[model samples]
Target: VPDITNVQVQINTGAPGYSPLETEQRITFPVETAMAGLPGLQQTRSLSRSGLSQVTVIFKDGTDIFFARQLINERLQVAKEQLPDGVEAVMGPVSTGLGEIFLWTV
Candidate 1:
């Protein structure tokens, strides 16, 4: 089995009461810039709406789960400082191949 890990980040796009589109526009640039050039990052998907910005990071196969989580957190730590005011980046739960158990064939 491949050792794959998923790291997700969520950030508040603006102060309370802002419109969703406005909030997304406010934080999109900085958030994208912050997550760029991350090591071991194989792919990234992002979503922004209703004052919420979420990013999912996928690491390459065989990447150490613990190390991958730590690496992502470290990059996010620095990115936090560069984010727009009132925006806070928070990491989601750690997910690895071992965390899944369902198998099916169709």
Candidate 2:
């Protein structure tokens, strides 16, 4: 398989106790809106939970991962402005399916 060409955005609502609907409206939607129309973007998937929102940005095959991340980083700046105070949207680690070499069971 090819390297995983995707970027993930994690949003932590520092203060807890947020409902799913609130998280979706206040966090997920805005983030999704910010990511729309990104070049080389294939599609985006998101999940809004109690205190967190995860947005996975998938890019088309053959697209450079580094370039994709750079685009995401720039867009995140715009997203930050629309986010609530203390709520930060950060990128997840750089990992690929082939990076998994082994699995250990304890």
Candidate 3:
């Protein structure tokens, strides 16, 4: 199987007690907006929960994952300015669904 070209952006609102709506408004939207217009970007899906926001960026098939991540890394710098103090967005590990080579069951 071929590796999937995708990136996951995780936002951790350091402070707790944030409601889902607030997280969506403050974290998710800004991140999604920052990711807009990226080359080879297929779609972006986001999930906003209390104190956390997860955005998955799916690129077109055959897109270079490294280049995609670089684009995201640069954009995230700009998005940081819009985020609240202490809140930080970090990209998840670079792994695809079929990248795993080991499987174990206990």
Candidate 4:
């Protein structure tokens, strides 16, 4: 595969209070920039009578390598700005790790 110029990603699913606007089983998180990278996604929280969530993203990946980089960047930026106040979001290519680990070995 060629070099992956970039990748686009977001927090899909489990976004608290994100259903009203993005009513869907899988909801992508907000992003700031295209090149910007986000951390791993965590569960949403209900704190202080407020609704918020976290979404992570990355760039390097096995898929989306080549071509669609520029376009993906645009989307990332938009997602970031569009995030709600209580919603903490990030941007980047989606991450896929088939690798398994943390097994108790005797």
| Candidate No. with top lDDT | 3
lDDT of 1 by residue, 1-106 (tens): 6644454433334436556666556655566666677677777777776767766666666666677667767777777777667767777665543445434321
Given candidate 3, what's the lDDT at residue 73?
90
Tens digits of lDDT, candidate 2, 1-106: 4544344333333325678888889888898899899998888888888888888887787777788888988998999899888888888777664444433321
Q: List the candidates' TM-scores in order.
A: 0.65, 0.80, 0.81, 0.29
lDDT of each: 0.62, 0.76, 0.78, 0.37
What is the per-residue lDDT of model 3 for residues 35-66, given as tens digits with 9 covering 90 to 100? 99989888898888887888888888777778
Query: What's the CA error at residue 4 for candidate 3, in Å?
Result: 5.8
* Residue-by-residue lDDT tens digits, candidate 4, 1-106: 3333334343432346544446221233233232344232122221121133333344444434233344445555566566545444333343433211223332
Stretch of 10 with least lDDT, candidate 4: 41-50
lDDT for position 80 in model 4: 52
lDDT, candidate 4, equals: 0.37
| Alpha-carbon runs more than 4 Å astray in model 3 | 1-15, 99-106
The CA lDDT at 48 in model 1 is 71
* Root-mean-square deviation of every model: 4.6, 3.2, 3.1, 10.2
Better of 1 and 2 by TM-score: 2
